[model samples]
Target: MWPLPVRPERSYSGEIRNFSKLFGTERNRFGSLHKLTLYYLPIAIFVAVYVLIILRNLRWFRIPVWTIMMAGAVAMIFSGAIPLGDAYASINLNVIFFLLGMFSVVAGMDLSGLLEYLTLKLLRVAKSPQKAFGLVLIGISMMSAFLVNDTLALMATPIMLSVAKQLRIRPGVFLITLALGVTIGSTMTAIGNPQNLLIALSTGIPNPMLDFLYYLAPPTLAGLGVTYLILRWYYRKEFANSTLAQLQVNPREAIKDRKLAKLSGWAAGIVVLGFFLVGIAELFGIQGNFNLGTISLLGATIVFLGSGRRREILRSVDWGIILFFISLFIVMQAFWESNALQSLMIYLPVLNRSDPGLSLVTIILASAFFSQLLSNVPFVAVYIKAMQAAGFTGADVKAWMALAGASTLAGGISLLGAASNVIVLEEAESRGSGFGFVEFSKIGLLVTIPNLLILYLFLRVL
Candidate 1:
């Protein structure tokens, strides 16, 4: 079957007749809605797998998320919901390789003991329990602005569990603060997280790093303050009258292989520089199309070659999550091809020349629950595409900025809101301390709603 639908050439009158069914217009093109019903079977299969996967913890069957998503992708292809060529086209290789490269680099950092070193250093600086919690929060926030927060969360959570035991601090506060800070600081920079990276790469964002810092940093910083207060308020007894338990840990002991560390660190530097120089250099008469994925892959190659145990570090690249993202890209494209997102254009006011404040508010409100419903990354992809169809182009600087701000901020709205939160929860559980979905949401609401409201007001005045 052809990957793209073949539509009959119709006059204005005929098109007007089909206007109400635009998103599902395939029915009209096929001559009957019944003929197109089976094409949507993949959606049902995908939804069933999705629901069951989320319930895996209830039973002893521990199926990975990647498994379910890939099953959906395969089912869609087999059922002709998405053609083979369309499925291939739907996967964004850039995002996949970008994630793999970053994961490889962080895996090297793990080999060099950098994660342990940084985690220990952050813990040693606190003089008391309150100071410790605050210090940890700042460290996580700062680290997330540049490094991948998921990597940080995976490595840091175990160390934090150790801190919880020694310092007698509540594991809930320490873990939750880490989750909050990771989400908040990620909004400060495009490179901090995946959603930001996607927005930065998509057209309409100018000077990604500079633009984010200037516009998003203010509210994100403010939100961090709110996160701190709410956490302290909720965990007041946990933070009060705490003794400084000198860490029995020494970071130096972990660095038997400094050679891999230095190589990984150098590779990270090169990749970061490459990201900044990619398109900016073109403005200065340098002619080349540089991509973050290729450059980061180069960094990964460097680490792989230098590290003697390439197989071991390569094995740790979170391949499951990467595959999950790839399958997700394809499944999401089905919705896009069906014009499901384009239909949202009508609800959104014209973003090209609309009031900046109103546009910001609309994007924020829509992205908040939208993200929770389908996850932030998918929502951003659909939202950005929808707005572009609605006349919000790269020239609409405010629109894209609003998207980056609202999408990233809204990722903290619930437990399913962001990958980092889920990572922390899963990782914490492995270490014998983790909260349920209800507790996470209860804590999240205490800070998220108020912070989002303040940001809405702040944007209105700006």
Candidate 2:
């Protein structure tokens, strides 16, 4: 038989029209509806049903919270809410690969007993409860800067809980400390947080380790100092009768498998080195870069093939978080293609201004506030296009960069505020030392208020 001609892909409008037929239910709307009844009726029905389901949380037709979010994202993307571009997809791929590599290396470290051994040794050196708190704060912070806050919190929370149980101190307070430390530390590097990556990609900010510190370092120092002081005041009564003498645990005892520890450390080091090498190579505009994710997968493959630890690593990885990013990336791409974000920027009163510094401060404050409401990653992507459309210059770009950084930092102030916050809290809870949102937000407010102001002031000075 003669082959049937392949039809051209239907336009988006055509596809939507076809999908509309599935939900076509007649309704008497105010006795007589307008001429565009078919389109209007179906949309009205969909909206009514959707709102009802949401408000009632109906069991029969309920969707997962994530799926609902993705649906809104689809609307926003086509409606110009997000405004991420094709270029963003490439950047995201790099980010995903980098994260994958990092995760693999971290998995190896966890399985190899390196992280556990290091945790114990660090704790042992900390001896007294006060010192232990300090070390835990510093260690988790440093790890987060390199490994990202989410991973650092996931792996470290249980270990911190174990230490708290042994030392007989309040784990909740320390858990808070660990959580804040990671949030603060994450501001130091682009790889530390998703928003940081967005800022880097959008603003063309290079050497985040250095560029970020121009604004972030000072605030982070203030945050760290403030965090310490806050913890001290809060925990002063707790530490009043205790000492920080190093706990008596032999280093050898902590190393369950020295061979595995060495292998894991080496693998992790290679993954980290890849980032540094890529950063350096960027100076010459070279490609062939392997990101954190790819490096992690490589390390994971090694561990899986050689150490027989693939199953455990796969089970342990945050698959949900990974999928969230994938969906997020697609939606962001849609926003970029649709130019939805640009339209939103046109509507923002702050960007329709003449003063550069004022524009800078406004963007910073706006980003900080919205980040608390919307996820920082999406917020960053949206505003980045807004800032660009507003004709941000070199210095203006710097201001926007600072704004993105501060917005993410603001997330440190609330529990329902950031992904990292939820991850850390959930992990701690899993180990029987969970914290409440009210409690965390109470402490977070103290940190966020002052820290955001400091960030604003620093940006003004620059």
Candidate 3:
């Protein structure tokens, strides 16, 4: 039989050392797992959402974007990737409220028939196919600078189609023009689209409205002009030997509620005027900490309560979109806390350089290309975080403005590149024939490339 081993003395110090070893092993294991879950899980969820968005056929089943965002957020919470409070705090309420207001006001205007009346009047003046094309460009571009491009696309697509039908021309080019117009024009103002709103709120510029007007507006106008010419040339065959013909639309008949239409118009005017006043007020330090979202929501609430179409308008409001924003915040915040993005940026040190002009161009290019792949709204959300992680400063508003322009304008490069463009395409389909993806990309890229080139030059020079 083997001799029995001698037992060690039962000392407290030895027991303590054993305990420390056990504790350290458990801690290291836990930490490693935590880091993995924090980064990979959210990235997986983010990618899944992006995939669903890219594949248009999946939308036929009516899977709302909110569903995907919620799933990602819930996964993060359950995985312990982020604390509940931090995740909740990640959402920018100001941006959410702003989008809500835009939705309600747009719904109110459309329901009040004010949108139809104005659109018909614009259509009536387009005497020919070429004139109709030019007129559509002008109207849509201007409207998108103030009105969210998606709302204008929904309202204007049918109006433009009516003009095209009257002129005996293909509706495809006209509809595409509207999609491209809104995509380009939305770059003109902070309130122009959700992405712009997100960028403005994130940067906290003292006078975001003025900044947009001064730095970005000129470029936006140039882009629209160039886009107009490109579209005109591309559709030249369609307008060959055509003369300006009077539009068949009757503005009077299109106005269903005379008083309501007038009221909605005034409400829109007041909201726009309020934007400037509030922006200027903040600029002069009267209400330096003022939130433009509040002003916009105030306008929305007034129009909602006064328009007498509460049921219809409220029901039409994009609540899903609001939810999507909230969930996206939670998911992105987890990613931000993960530190993976910061680690990745070590590979691109030049992007984090301190030159405002060069940095702005870099951001614009990154945002524009990824926007075509990921869609501008979500891309902006994630990209802004990435920028912050890269040590980007908001000291210069030019970079943010450049991103706003590049991202919004990049939507014109592909049919699937933007939410507003998708809305226009679907609406056009419901009305009549639509352009296929191949045809759309051909013209879309042709126009968008030159505009981006012009914008890059404008930013570099001025």
lDDT tens string, model 2, 294-368?
A: 555666566556665667666766655555555556554544444445445555646744776777678767866
- On TM-score, the leading prediction is 3
Q: Ten residues in a row with the worst lDDT in model 1?
A: 31-40
Alpha-carbon deviation at 83 in model 1, angstroms: 3.3
lDDT of 1 by residue, 431-450 (tens): 78887788888888787787
For model 1 the local lDDT of residue 293 reads 73
Q: Report the error of model 3 at residue 330, Å.
A: 1.4
RMSD of each: 9.9, 10.6, 3.8
Better of 2 and 3 by lDDT: 3
Ranking by lDDT: 3, 1, 2
Clashes of each: 1, 20, 3
lDDT of 1: 0.74
Cα TM-score per model: 0.83, 0.76, 0.91
Supply candidate 2's per-residue lDDT for 115: 73
- Per-residue error at 178 for model 1, in Å? 1.5
lDDT of 2 at 242: 58
lDDT of 3: 0.78
How far does residue 233 in candidate 3 sit from its true spot (Å)? 1.0
